[model samples]
Target: MPSRRQVLALLAALPAVLGLPEEARAAEPDVTAGPDWDATDIAVLKGVLAAVYGPNSDRCDAVEALTASFAWLDGERKALVRMLPSLFDQASRVLVPTISAFHDLDPVQQQACVDDWAASPLAFRRQIFGALRQLLLAHAYADPATWPDIDYPGPWLGRYELPIHPLRFGDPELP
Candidate 1:
């Protein structure tokens, strides 16, 4: 039979093996998420701006593509956070105007607009790109997976039933 000391020693070593205590681990060199913003995930916002309004502007298409590509990332960030209400507000503002503008254009004109925007000089693309980066950065920090299940936004498709038996409550008397 193993001695008590041996068991205790093994148990002590178990944490090391499993990496149970995160703080005890040796520090790793911090790496930025990407080239665009800054050390604190701000760069993600910057990258979005760069892709959009930079010298080769693709602000219209790039914003849409970036948002679409990061659909999963959106879930990671969740919809409403208190601290970033202003930032979210800003994004909402841009999205509203841009979405309105996009819809207003005829289909062919919209396509041409996007194509033209994509081909624009890099400088102009930066305008809307930063907001995109902010979105991605927020998602990483917020970790939307931890959010609780919420009812669907607009409405429920079907009726909800209470668990009580029908007999528990007598049917309404005929008028």
Candidate 2:
């Protein structure tokens, strides 16, 4: 059922996706996750943030941003996040039987857990990982505190009032 082009495209990406030394495209996978978590759950969240965002990610108040983002989600999503930790055990491919609590795991273990879920063989696990990551990332990018590091000056709209000199919303004809 494979088309030649699709097959070829996958074949082309295979070498790079294989973790080859020279392949830079897959050198780093963009992994992100956000959760609608409880106060008690946040202790582990900070560790996950440090692991997923790397050592220098503490400048932004990610905890607050994540908390706010979590607050905005509905009941179903909130429940999923509450349960995300338990799902971690199902994501790992390694034979490191009897995984510890996420908070108890070292930083390296946390990162591995995220990576495993993101790239899990089970589609649902990957889907949840994708959803969690996207949720966090969307909120983080929207937070003004995160802008300085990325060098984004706040939105231009705030600084500029475009002149509607020739036309207004009502008039369709050109001025």
Candidate 3:
């Protein structure tokens, strides 16, 4: 049985023993959620996309396209969206030197952090970077609006626009 004073002393020392700062021992604030992501998560992702794709160019608006891509992803790629917050949190903890979220960093810092992750020897970090890059590229290229800028003339003869033509092999009047 410990004295009350001894118990108080032990409680005060507990944080240090656990390797956590007193402030860090407190409960974290709830992340403010958006439709598919928390605000910070969305900001972190947008920053990453901007770093990888570059700012909107004359050929295509990368930011707009990325926004649209996120919207598409929310509907079609729920798993990815669901994973983003945790992934961003993990990256922030691993990459940021000081106590700060990824979205809290400045653009230059964000880019540097992402670059560091990209250059990391760890296979998983590289894989995450590759996956993010591929996601951006896939979305950017998939949009028909971006095709002309990429110099893809699209289908040979507006095949998508052609109405369903019934088989004419057996019917002479089908033409």
Candidate 4:
């Protein structure tokens, strides 16, 4: 009969004897699950935009900024949403608030943001799209997904998808 000490030692060494090596067991890398933006995040964004652009900026600027912001956020959200599409069905949760918050503004107040922006269509588009690209890049780096099928549309598909989708104003590839 094996003593308790011998039994315990054998149990500990059983894995090696069975050919299951310790090296085979490794922990998975940590990936953040999803966007955790809350109301405070919205407030922070609003405050930041207001501060950088100034309080008196009009609706056109606000909407244009928002359009650009959404384009960028779409890239970020799409990256995550594609990874766990079923889990992150509520990707619009982050964006909807931005629209609603702007919608809540009275007409005059909204226009103020618009008037403050550059009149050149190209400049406006550039600023908006640039901001969005940066935002999405930041999001992708933070929550990378290993799955390939979860990728966002490439340039070709991106153009096709944006205009048809209500969330996008126009194609990012456009001049």
Candidate 5:
């Protein structure tokens, strides 16, 4: 019973109404240049990392490295990185509503807040904790400075001892 004009109007609006090309609608913020984390946010992240890792260790350096690495990450990982600041900020409030921010709290309070997230039953909280852990721990331990503490021998300096062999896909001796 719709008029010709009405039908044409609906057809023209169909894409927007039905949310076609969902990716366009769901496009994440561009963090290609780097994460938008400010000094306060970075400090908060450092505090969280201190709690997750150990205080005054290499965590601050690892955090700086992780922040710097955001620029080279793909869009999905960049989006994840972007979420971290807001998520931590919100968690700070949820954990201590009276505090102005997570970093404002004492080290023990900050650790407790981070512990809450680490022990959370929600998958998102757990995911955030896991991501922070993996990022900080990976960067911290991978640094050459920490190698001495862990007794890790530095990168091998030995050159190739074995001569290179050409590929032989079907050779019976390959196994």
Candidate 6:
């Protein structure tokens, strides 16, 4: 076994080596939760957003987008989503032992936590990271404010007014 000094050195390097930040939380990042999401879920979602995007990403209306996102889900899926916060917390306990939830950690720490999961050895964890990332992109990018960042000039509704092609999937009379 390693000596005490070696263990302390390891602990100091834990954040970078393990992707769990050791810095104190400077401030709480602002994020809006939908009516369907409880505070805990919202917190976890905020942590995810900070990790995927920058910590200061506050332009997009997360609440509105998530509300619509959840509306399309079936009851079973919604229940599963509702339980994700606790699940994330339980899994992340090793990283931030003092914190009750993943979001309780500082943004830097939260990002570290997300990074850990994204690169986790477990396939399940990697899948969870992908799902969270895709979910954020789905809703966050839907907001017009984020369109410029991704060079997405919103949807093309003018397709109805002017046909880009003679044969379209939605158009009738296609053989």
TM-score of each: 0.21, 0.57, 0.54, 0.20, 0.65, 0.63
lDDT of each: 0.39, 0.63, 0.65, 0.39, 0.73, 0.69
Candidates, ranked, TM-score = 5, 6, 2, 3, 1, 4
Best by TM-score: 5
- Among these predictions, the greatest lDDT belongs to 5
Per-residue lDDT for 1-175 in model 5, tens only? Answer: 9999999988777768887654664575544587878887787777777777674564237777888888888867777776776677667687544455676778888777777777888897788778877887787777776676768887665644666677677667767
Ranking by lDDT: 5, 6, 3, 2, 4, 1
Estimate the TM-score for candidate 2.
0.57
Model 1 stretches astray by more than 4 angstroms:
1-71, 74-100, 124-175
User: In candidate 4, where is summed lDDT lowest over 10 consecutive residues?
Assistant: 84-93
Task: Name the lDDT of candidate 1.
Answer: 0.39
Better of 3 and 4 by TM-score: 3
lDDT of 1 by residue, 38-91 (tens): 232333233333333333332224333333444333332433221232342243
- Enumerate residue pairs that collide in model 5: none
RMSD of each: 16.8, 17.1, 16.3, 17.6, 9.2, 21.6
Backbone clashes, each candidate: 24, 4, 0, 15, 0, 0
lDDT of 6 at 63: 44
What is the lDDT, from 0 to 100, of the residue 154 in candidate 4? 39
Model 6: residues with Cα > 4 Å off, grouped in runs: 1-35, 95-100, 158-175
Residue range 31-144, candidate 4, lDDT tens digits: 333344455434433433443344442221442333333433433554542332122112222333334333244444433323332232557334543453344334332332
Candidate 4 TM-score, true structure as reference: 0.20
Superior by lDDT: candidate 1 or candidate 3: 3
